[model samples]
Target: MANRGRLFWKILLGFWLIFLLTTQLLWAVFTLYNPRHEAPEDNIARRIGNVQIGTAGAVLARGGLQALEELKASWPPDERKFFSDSPVVDAPPQGEGALPSMQQTRGAVSRLVMAPDGQRYLLRYDLDGLRNEYHQGRRSSILHMPPPLFWLGLTGGLLFSLLLAWNLTRPMLQLRRAFERVSRGDLSVRLFPVMRRRHDEITDVAKDFDSMAERLQVLVSDREALLHDVSHELRSPLARLQLAIGLAHQNPKNVYASLDRIEHEAGRLDRMIGELLALSRAEHQGALGEDYFDLLGLVEAVVNDARYEAQVPGVDIQLTAHQPEDYTVKGNAEMMRRGVENIVRNALRFSAHGQSVFVSLSRVDSLLEITVADQGPGVEESKLSSIFDPFVRVNGPLNGKGYGLGLAITRKVVLAHGGQVEAFNGPGGGLAIRLRLPHWE
Candidate 1:
């Protein structure tokens, strides 16, 4: 149909025409390979000679030698255009003297047969009639193709080409429809069900489309949830600021207390705003200045700062290295430091007093693996997987710490650097977070 795309028709008609031409070409080749029919003149001549022989033999069988002689004379000499003008040479029969004498002569375009009854008889035929008869027979042979096979081949080819074209374009059509739906904000549209298990480049493309759609759905959903949480978070600070301003207006003489509260709320708002910006940057911003930096030294610096901070609870921060070599990595040193510091500080916040928060760095192949484990109460196993999500937290002493952006930022920064982060409950009754980064060789 005309509604089919150009590619569809191109494939359909192209294959259909090609197959038809190929069938005709093969037939011609085979026809040529076999011997051709006898020439028209030879066929006509042989047929005429046989008819004359049969007529003469029948005359002899029914009416004896006299009948054949009269019949031979009856065919007029003028009708024998294939006859030669040469006179016949008299000769005796070669064998069987009891039989009548026989004579035969070969001419350039005609043949003469003397009757066996000792008579010089010649059977003749019109050359034009012979030619017309031969042409008629030849036409019959030429038109004698089997109808069933002819129709079957043509019909089968049409069906085969149609099926092939349909198979080739069906996936593309499905993909086009899926893309149309997705562009209209239907992120749930998927191409996998339409693919139907065919394993080809087209199927591969469908799989990739499905993956893209699924990722888009997750991204849209997450962005919506993050927006809701942000609105809720901003309302609290704005309300506190408004209330502080109203209190200051109520008691002008005692405005210092309200001023301090306003300043505290303002500072809170500033930190939250700064953290929000960092989270956004982690998700969408490029690398924080590419440089090769020593990861072990960064860990030690973060540990020293955390140790000073941890002194209030007497929590210990321990660092261990499995290898003595420098763990050089390529990324923004500041981003990696912040990510590692967040994990360690979060661990320290929940760690029981006098308990150690262990930090270990090791190399496996081309990867630098950093694991931070604390002796604090770990999160629920079900919530462990989603702890890195924005604004997600479990019931713990550190639940309200830092608006829950620390781990999320850590995940984003690590992912941007082509690394991975995972969290799980440690065997020794605390939480453990691991970071795997590609080491610069």
Candidate 2:
């Protein structure tokens, strides 16, 4: 649950820390690599020693009286260690082959650092000389290398932070544009967000919003179409029936039949109106599944009412219960019974003579399942969905039958009750219409 400000600062601080750490490392290495450790190239002792070393070798070879007498007569005993008297190394006087050996421990003033040849040596230097040479190298390295890499890293990090900010802000802009489109009544807007492989909650929220917008678009479109079609269809039957009733006195019995037909059409039209109203209300009713009614009683009443107008095909309503008692449901009872009646009526309308219209209401797992089936020619699979749409008829062109709002009404009622309705081909070659409602066990 990291907050936005916290996350932003975390990333910014992360980049800044990297730049600072790298610069510090480079600065440390530059400071530590002083060039004073290596041996100097040339020294003052080498030049001074080259002139005196040869003469001192000869002077020590004839050291019987002249060398020792000269060493004591001219050389000061206090300065004997500072100045070498001779370099006849390990010589012995009056021996077969030997030279005088005199050694002194003077300070390392360009000390004769032997080149390891045991015959020649390189002269070296002291503290003041080492410091003066090392200072220049250390100063130059510090002045040049560390500053450039540090500034380069700083600049790169700043640019990187900017690029990262741009990357994050771009997706937000896309979502804004999508919202703008939706505001202007284009509801099909979708966003294709660009991100790394990680999944964040913001991405999930955007997806959920997109899904909600899609459902809203579909429902609005359907409602608009339903309104237009209902208005258009209602006007026709109402105008015709009014005209037919206005002229009902020409032949008494035939006029009565005309009125009855008009009444039937009027009743059908009224049912359509009621269904459309229910559809409208259900869209806004939220959830109202508190009411429970007997599913068996509802189906029985609807089927018996359907038998009144059923002449061509006799109504054969059957109820098969796994349990003997009536199975009740939690729904609007009147609305649910009307829904079932529409299905039974439609089945009776389409079925042939002696063909049965079967109905079953049962309870299974806290669900009341009602199935109304008929031995009529089953609807085509393609037309099944269309038939649920208002004014879409399953009757062929030859049979100009009732308005096709029955199934649509049934679907509306089922949905309002938090239930589902479906149609399919029965196992034994018939149209099987089923409704499922939540029931109290």
Candidate 3:
């Protein structure tokens, strides 16, 4: 959580700095491309001074010093200061030493003028004072931005960055917390409901998380149920073995019968343990060996082996192949054989005397399907789905011979091979079990 906070701040600052720097760079480029021209106040002062000096020079030249003085005296005090004139009593120097065209004195423009009677005077206009007045009234430049607008933009960028960062990190933070809860064995945690409105990649991730959690919950529940069933199954056999031992101790004359009963119970326990181990191995897909084998050959072998068992009940077992070609499948041969044998033997167990069990192998689309069906009492419609569960059995004369792990092992082995197994009541009134595996081309 602390790390997420750091990430949020990093994103906010990164975006804000990028925006600010880009804005400043553009401003610099604009300033460089359009350089400022001469100030308006300076231009105005220069033009006004030229006009004033020209007017004063004309008055002195036509009206002499007395007339010029009278003109100055008639003007307002403020206006008189700008049009002062001084007499030039000295004669003009030789051609090369004549007065310069005009002289620019400090803060003033001075011009030499001669009257028609040969009288000369110097006319002057104060330009520096005029420039100062204009400068005081001028406004600031348009090229540069003001402080208030700059601060407003900065604040806006910060807020936008913060909002973007929060939107991104908030979902990530929720995912992290949900993962933490799952790690602590809280499989009920879900994310899609809270995040579905986003409609983005994060929402997809939330949906995936919810699926994973649900799968884990189911697996854990199944494991606990299996454990409970195993313990219950073991308790019944152990109780029977103990009763046989007590009877043998009380009656020494029937010790041989007690010993035979003990041996039978022991064998049953061994068979049950072996089936449990097979179920566990099937459940772990990684432990199986990979190989390619013929589905028709495997089904034929299972049907032949069940024939010997079927003879006891006078049940007939038949095998049929829909296609001439032997369908090939890829997986552990031994596990596949065991899975097929379990389904065939289960069918034989349910079958009555004079009944027949049908085993068929065929190709359906891209899959190899093996179906084992019995001509006996079928399972209840509602309980058909759970027939493959461990320790689940339908009441029958031979039900005691099984620990109810055969169908469960078959289901696990088929699943491990990326196949499917299902049970349904046959149309003619018996149970049918179908196994489908991917066909190896």
Q: Model 1 over residues 251-318: C-alpha lDDT tens digits?
A: 89658988888898888788888888888887764645678999999999999999999999899999
Q: Residues 1-441, candidate 3, lDDT per residue (tens digit)?
A: 356688798899998887777666666676577655445666677677777777667776677777777877877887776666667788573243233366775478888887656766677888777766655523453335444445655887788888889999899899999999999999999999999999999999999999999999999999999999999999888898998999999999768988998899999999999999999999998887778898888788778888987888899999989867758888899999999999888888888999999988888899888888998889999999988999898654376698889989999999999999999999999999999999988
**Total backbone collisions, model 1:** 0
Q: Per-residue lDDT for 1-441 in model 2, tens only?
A: 143445455566677677667776766676578565333432333333333343434443344325534754564554333333322334332333332232222223332221112222222223333344445453344434545566776787767765665556556666777788888989987653443233776577577768878897988899789878878888988887877776776556569778787987788788767766765554443544567777777776777777766654555656565668657677577667777888887888778778888888776676778888888888888887787787778666225555666788788888877788899988787799988887766
TM-score, candidate 3, is 0.76
- Which candidate comes out best when scored by lDDT? 3
Residue 36, model 1: Cα distance from true site in angstroms = 3.8
Clashes of each: 0, 3, 0
lDDT of candidate 3 at residue 101, scale 0 to 100? 63
lDDT (C-alpha) at residue 92 in model 1? 47
Worst 10 residues of 2 by lDDT: 113-122
